[model samples]
Target: MMLQDIDAVIFDLDGSLVDSMWIWEQIDIEYLGRFGIALPDNLQYEIEGKSFSETAHFFKERFQISDPLQKIKDDWNEMAWNKYSYEVPLKNGADSFLAYCKANDIKLGIATSNSRELVMNVAAVHGLEHYFDCIMTGCDVEKGKPAPDIYLAVADALKVDPSRCLVFEDIIPGILAGKAAGMKVCAVEDAYSEAIRAEKKELADYYIKDYTDFSSLY
Candidate 1:
């Protein structure tokens, strides 16, 4: 909806604010290949909303990897660094929408399942570090999306009531997390989640193909 109705706007980083979802699947394939394990077709769906740490744990247990969890995370971060630094781009019109939010004095924050290092790298790449009031990762909370912990933690960090916050997300679990936190949720369209568009529309209060769509709302 309109900016006037919300005091804060929280965003999910990966598919929501940037076109980087493709990188993860590539990483998963490459990483698992290193262990001589074939990538499961359902792997992405299985780990949809899990935190970085949780995903590492899943990989460790599910694949029976011998490496410690931290090593797994570190290796992933290393593999993803160059790609995120070079290839990932912000979603269409995201910069302008961030600018609009800044101009309107609306607080902004990121509640992402991604690691803090990666999310920060994304901000640096797009010169978006200054746009956020808070940048929280799922590791900061006990649970990830669909449980509402990360979004709630972010709202608390921003000192805003959950009801006064609006969330932009691109996946079903993220939309569910925002709604569970009592915030209005806007489902963002991303090719990675295109197959589940109808479920997203049904679950979210609003849906947009890109940040540019916000222009029509006002």
Candidate 2:
């Protein structure tokens, strides 16, 4: 009832449900360091919500790095696999919120920019594989966040109307994507995106500091 007749809840993985946004920052620093290139101060903002493949391309073009896109992706995937499996922890109240959805018979799905292998591996490691009815990646769609494609795909897979889905996201692009898909978007607070929190809040239909802030809705 609090969710106002929402039939499904879709989540963005990295910052919304999992405390794993640091991995990308670490990867950016280390990856560019190998080439003796310093990571730019605005680099994080530049690629904040891009898909893995789009990020690889950005690195290659912006940094003038010689590595191929596939190579960069492979390297990042290998580097992140360990952290995702063993170190990344779920966000506070994330488990509880997921349980709430299940108990209330709300279909759940994941619309993520992460690679499929890493996503599945992390899910398996955390024993979260069964929590979602559908898990879709940016790669599964033609375009990533800010395009509405990924979110739309998840809605399609879940057989839910876009208007009946509630999306939780931690970044601006994701919030925009959800809105573009005709769903209500809630911006989940994440430290990595703190600087742009106001923008996110302005763009999203609602904002939550975490899953605990259920005063508005889940």
Candidate 3:
């Protein structure tokens, strides 16, 4: 299917444009270790598209952290940010895809569930800031992914119609949010297992195994 009508493309940061989900896995292990809980071998599918507050609630409730959830998230952010500062790399074919969007005059923006500080820093550290017309984070909205708020806000800020923009997402909640906002939604495979893949396949309009598959998308 041709994404010929797409005038803009919005990207989800962690798993879609950059392979940073694995970083979260490492952090989860360490965080749980500090609390003497055995970390699950997998955390991505549960955590994707959730905000700090929401994630904190999940960890707290699931593992009984006992502290205020916000504090837990803050501590995690402090720990994660240190590594996020230097380790961001564009996923395979992402830079080329960005270039393709630019060359064709398609508007670009980042609509991520990540914090603004982390998102901005990663974009700059990897020289991706210049390609985007706007950058928006989940903090900017009252509702994060699974709610249309962030994607809706990014489309608004870009001054584009929602129908004219497409979204690249790695999780079902994000895909649902984008589609609910009346945009075409595409999924980028980011190391999900078969079970995860079957679960996420239903939410996205299209699925791509790699960025190379997105080359002719527009």
Candidate 4:
């Protein structure tokens, strides 16, 4: 892929750009224990790029969990949200990569499965909010990643063709979403999540270990 043909690069936050992915594991261990159900290691990767509500809904069905999982999410959100202030680390080279995009006139934006408030907080906390021309959250669309709705919405907001947009994702669902939206997709290894480096074969158009002169693929 060549960067020259790309007009915008949309990113998936959480594991892809921020260190918050680990917080989810913590939340899983602590909360699921309250219900006495061991966290299902198999579901984490499948569930990335899902909205909090969607996740709650999933748990409801999967574990026969009671309804109004909203309260559980609210509690988890409270924990993870605060962590963004001092704990969430930006993925290595992420800041510099965004700077490079800005310098090169590449429009950047976030299309995340997280709530708008959560995404905004992470971006603001890391001083990454300024780089995004648009930030579309799962709440803004009927479907989250793997559905293409969010990415299409992002492309519309960026005023760029979906095919001209390149996506960077750390999870398979996010990559499927980008690809379904008709864009080129690139994968990033997320050390903290189940998206194992070895399993990256299915998630990325190009698997990148780190951002190093990496923007040339447009």
Among all candidates shown, the one with the greatest lDDT: 1
Q: How far off is model 1, as Cα RMSD?
A: 1.2
Each candidate's clash count: 0, 0, 0, 3
Off by over 4 Å in 4: 64-69, 193-199, 213-218
Put down candidate 3 lDDT per residue, 1-218, tens digits, no spaces.
Answer: 43588888999988888878778877888889998988775566677678766777888888988889668867877888867777757788888889888988989999988777778878878888889999988877888789999899999999999999999988888888999999998888877434577666777878878688876654
C-alpha lDDT of candidate 2 relative to the true structure = 0.88
Q: Which model is ahead, 2 or 3, in terms of lDDT?
A: 2
Q: Is candidate 1 or candidate 3 better by TM-score?
A: 1
**Estimated TM-score for each candidate:** 0.97, 0.93, 0.86, 0.88
Query: Taking the tens digit of each residue's C-alpha lDDT, what string does model 2 give over 1-218?
Result: 43887999999999998999988888888988999988799887788668878888888999898878899999999989899988999888787788878988999999999988888987898788888999998878888888999999999999999999999999888999999999999999999999888898899989888877762344
- Candidate number with greatest TM-score: 1
Query: Tens-digit lDDT track for model 4 on 134-197?
Result: 9988878888778999899999999999999998888877888998999998887777645366
Judged by whole-model lDDT over C-alpha atoms, candidate 4 comes out at: 0.81
Order the candidates by TM-score, highest first: 1, 2, 4, 3
The positional error of residue 6 in candidate 4, measured at the CA in angstroms, is: 0.7
lDDT of each: 0.93, 0.88, 0.83, 0.81
Clashing residue pairs in candidate 1 are none
